[model samples]
Target: MNSEFSYRLLPGLLPYYAFRVCTKFLQSQDLILPGVIIGFLANGFNIFSNWLFIFQFELGVNGAPWATSLTRAIQFIFMILYLLWRKDSLADTWPSFSLRKLSYNVVKPFLTLAFSGMFSFAAEAWSFEVTTILAGLLGTIALDSHTITLNIATFIYLSFPFAVGIATSIKVGQLIGEGKAADARRSAIVAYGVNFAVQITLIAIVWPCSRLIASLFSKDEEIVDLVASLIPLSCIFMLGDAVQANTGGALRGLGRQKLVLLLNILGFWLLAVPFGAVLAFATNIGVRGLWWGFTVGLYSAAFIGILFLVFRVNWEKEAFKAQRRIAQTSQ
Candidate 1:
């Protein structure tokens, strides 16, 4: 509850939220290196604060959440200061005078985007959490294997295509905002190509090093063996995962927030969870079945996302929508 409250309090920092979008906008404008530096600094502050509170103050586990809250607060302050310092880039977009003007135009579209985007991400996260719970039901060894494999997979994901997705999202959105629909489409295509190449390369590395990687996490032969087997499956999963993630990013860029939200729900909750549950319980495959179900769902989402991007999207219309949204919101 305390953690939840701290997270809830983040939206209260209006300027921070604005600056986050502004930073993404800036990235789209080809000013990405600075944003990356700032992001690194922010992450460093988060880690440093955690260390300070946990060790220096001897707060133990409680220190971690407090550190998170503190880091976000500091980030909010830093972003606001940065915006003020670089007023030229943000001055036109920044709201002034009546709060009503900002609320109706800017805040409305933002809320629309935020709510849908939040739901879309939440659906994916919740599906994974549900899978974890199901893994626990399998037995201690199964759950441990699942935990270790998931942690490693998540780490690899954060290290690679995840960043590409974010960068692509910003690039595509910015291009749309500027009415460069063709460029936005081209950016999405390039993002997909890059995601596939990187994921495939990582898959090769992971496949050969699976046992070694698993051993680093655990000394137990049984646990390590279980994790090693799962790694190959996870590599396969990454193919679909990379595609879905980047495609989702592209959809977000196109302001198809509601569509993305619907797709996530259909893919994860409607398809993945049920299929995984069935495979886990009704079949002899046990934990592996669960992962297979997850793979199927991911591929399902990836296929749908790719199809939408290639066949259904109207780039010009999306660009117009982005323009209207920003125009209506800005002072």
Candidate 2:
């Protein structure tokens, strides 16, 4: 009952959620540096709030949600104040809302994009969560090693290709808005090429230093060995992961969002999870089998995405679609 009540505090975070959407919209409009700065500050505030509530206040486990809600509320207020100070059109226009304008211009497209994008994100995330659950079922050592390895991989992902992918999405969309279909395609190609080169270099660096990296996270020899063994598989997984991530971003910019969402559903849910389950339980390979399944799904998604970009996409048509969408919403 206490936990449920604590969880109820999540509703207080709606403002932060709105703020994030606003930030992303700004970033999509090419205001990248401001958005990045604000996001960094917000994250720092969240961390500080967590430390204050959990350590200084001695609030225990429930401190986490309180810290999150408080930090979000503060961040939301900060964003609103900044917008007001700038006399931003978004703030100025908020009071002039009308049902007819919203229905035709915002709500229709918003719902269509939101549902598809939400499912795509959820499908990929849930597959990894399920993989974690399966790892826990393997044993304590397996779960610990898996957790540490996953953390390292996630850190690397967020550091480079993910950032590049987001920038690529925004840039592509901007180019499309200008009706430069060829330039948009070129941008995507360059983004994908750069991501590939960077990922390959990192893989080479990681392969030689796998044991050294694993040692940083664990003092246990068995855990270190397990993590080291997983690094090679992680390299393969990272390559596919980076490719699919970049491609998915490009697809979003091209306005083929429904297709992107479908691909994620097919790749992660229909393919990765069941295959990983079979390999983990039916074979003697254990936890590594789960990661192997992950590699397969990512590779499949990347291949399909790349193929679509190369052979199937009509850049001219996509540019026009982007133009129409932008024009509609701006009104």
Winning candidate number (lDDT): 2
Across 1-331, the per-residue lDDT of candidate 1 in tens digits comes to 5775466445435645655776765665677765666767878998998899889999777677677666666666776677678778766656468757666666777789899999998998999899999999999888889889889888888888788888788888889999999999999999999999999999999999999999999999989999999999888888888888898889988888888898888888888888988998899877777788878988898898889888999999889988887777665
In candidate 1, how many Å is residue 287 off?
A: 1.7
Q: Mind giving the per-residue lDDT tens digits that candidate 2 earns over 54-140?
A: 899998767778888887787777777766666665553443656766666677787887788888888888888999999999999
Clashing pairs for model 2 are: none
Candidate 2, residue 123: Cα displacement in angstroms equals: 0.4
Q: What residue runs in model 1 are displaced by over 4 Å at the alpha carbon?
A: 1-30, 97-108, 324-331
Residue 43, model 1, lDDT: 88
lDDT of 2 at 262: 89
What lDDT would each prediction earn against the true structure? 0.83, 0.84
Error of 2 at 324 (Å): 3.4
Return the TM-score for candidate 2, rounded to 2 decimals.
0.90
